[model samples]
Target: MATLVLAACGTDAAAPADRDDVGARVFAANCATCHGPDLGGTDRGPPLLHEYYLPDHHPDVVFATAIANGVQAHHWDFGPMPAIGGLSDDEVAAVVAHVRDEQRRAGLME
Candidate 1:
């Protein structure tokens, strides 16, 4: 399979085997468009950095389901989040990890 390693900041994101930050790469490739580079809400979707996603409020598993099955618009007017395709389980986990880490950094969770 031919995979492209597209990078924006890091200088060592050339070889896929050399990647140490899989979550960041995955987010950039998938969720960055709607979630923004910083995970802040954009015109398309709500920010993953919001307090609504606290570990107690929305568990990590919820993210996994949403990614696979898509989510309805309950909090914003962005409408339903259609299921994103072509990602492996590990890749989905990586994206979840990335979002959770950013949420913690933003003080949305303890």
Candidate 2:
């Protein structure tokens, strides 16, 4: 289970309905094991729903970069994140969109 943290701005902009679905599917297949299906913290990874993941600290691009290059452990004790392979650029974007949408729904973002 790898960690995939997605972030969102405080703006009201929303992801498209279709992209949201695709992103959710992609997330379930690749990220849910660690990140949880609801972006909640699992034993294996930190929660994206927390304030630490606010867009001010981690913008949407951070998610794409993390998935592409992985991240070192800095905020949590879970250990470094490993790069997620085999995702296309569009899939990455879709995952970001999904994460942003979930963040908004959880009130972590505007």
Number of the top-ranking candidate, with TM-score as the measure: 2
Give me the runs in candidate 2 sitting further than 4 Å from their true place.
1-15
Per-residue lDDT over 1-110 for candidate 2, one digit per residue giving the tens place of the 0 to 100 score: 12233323222245577668878999999999999988997999999888888779987777788888899978999999899999876678788878888899998788
Count of steric clashes across candidates, in order? 0, 0
Which candidate tops lDDT? 2
**lDDT per residue (tens digit) for residues 26-108 in model 1:** 88988888989999878998888887877787776778778878989887899998887897766666677677777767877
Enumerate residue pairs that collide in model 1: none
Judged by whole-model lDDT over C-alpha atoms, candidate 1 comes out at 0.71
lDDT per model vs. reference: 0.71, 0.80
* Model 1 bad stretches (over 4 Å): 1-20
- Residue 68 in model 1: lDDT: 76
Give the 10-residue window scoring lowest on summed lDDT in candidate 1: 1-10
TM-score of each model, in listed order: 0.79, 0.84
